[model samples]
Target: MERFYARERMGVQGSWSRHSAARVASAQALRGRDRLRAALSAMGFRLQ
Candidate 1:
């Protein structure tokens, strides 16, 4: 992990790490959006 950070700081390609990070972030965002939608729906809000 430290080696990865050092390479990243030095501007190495790091495509795999970047892609994995993006995927994780996207999944978390989707989960948060789903939770928010469910909360709103429970409050009687309708989504278009």
Candidate 2:
């Protein structure tokens, strides 16, 4: 896990399977097309 943070622009991608999140818009944030995927999943929606 230590090596994962060794990159110059270190960041985390994907959802936290064991936790919930609430994201807000910000300039530093990327274009997350799958951001709502987790919420949809909790509501019983499946993705391809």
Candidate 3:
């Protein structure tokens, strides 16, 4: 029981959790770019 609490307090967040955060952030950035491209195309403007 004490060991569990010690690990938690040590900030051992694990690679899986860290990877999840990075994946979510990247996904959000990709979504934002796609939205921008769609909006620009809707206005008859070329995104490239």
TM-score of every candidate relative to the true structure: 0.34, 0.29, 0.31
Tens-place lDDT digits, model 1, residues 1-48: 547757678544556677556645865646576477779988999987
Query: How much lDDT does each candidate structure score?
Result: 0.67, 0.51, 0.62
Task: For candidate 3, report its TM-score.
Answer: 0.31
lDDT of 3: 0.62
TM-score rank, highest first?
1, 3, 2
RMSD (CA, Å), each prediction: 8.1, 9.1, 10.2
Please tell me which predicted candidate would have the highest TM-score against the true structure.
1
RMSD from true fold, candidate 2 = 9.1
lDDT of 2 by residue, 1-48 (tens): 334444544554544431124343442342464467877888999977
Clashing pairs in 3: none
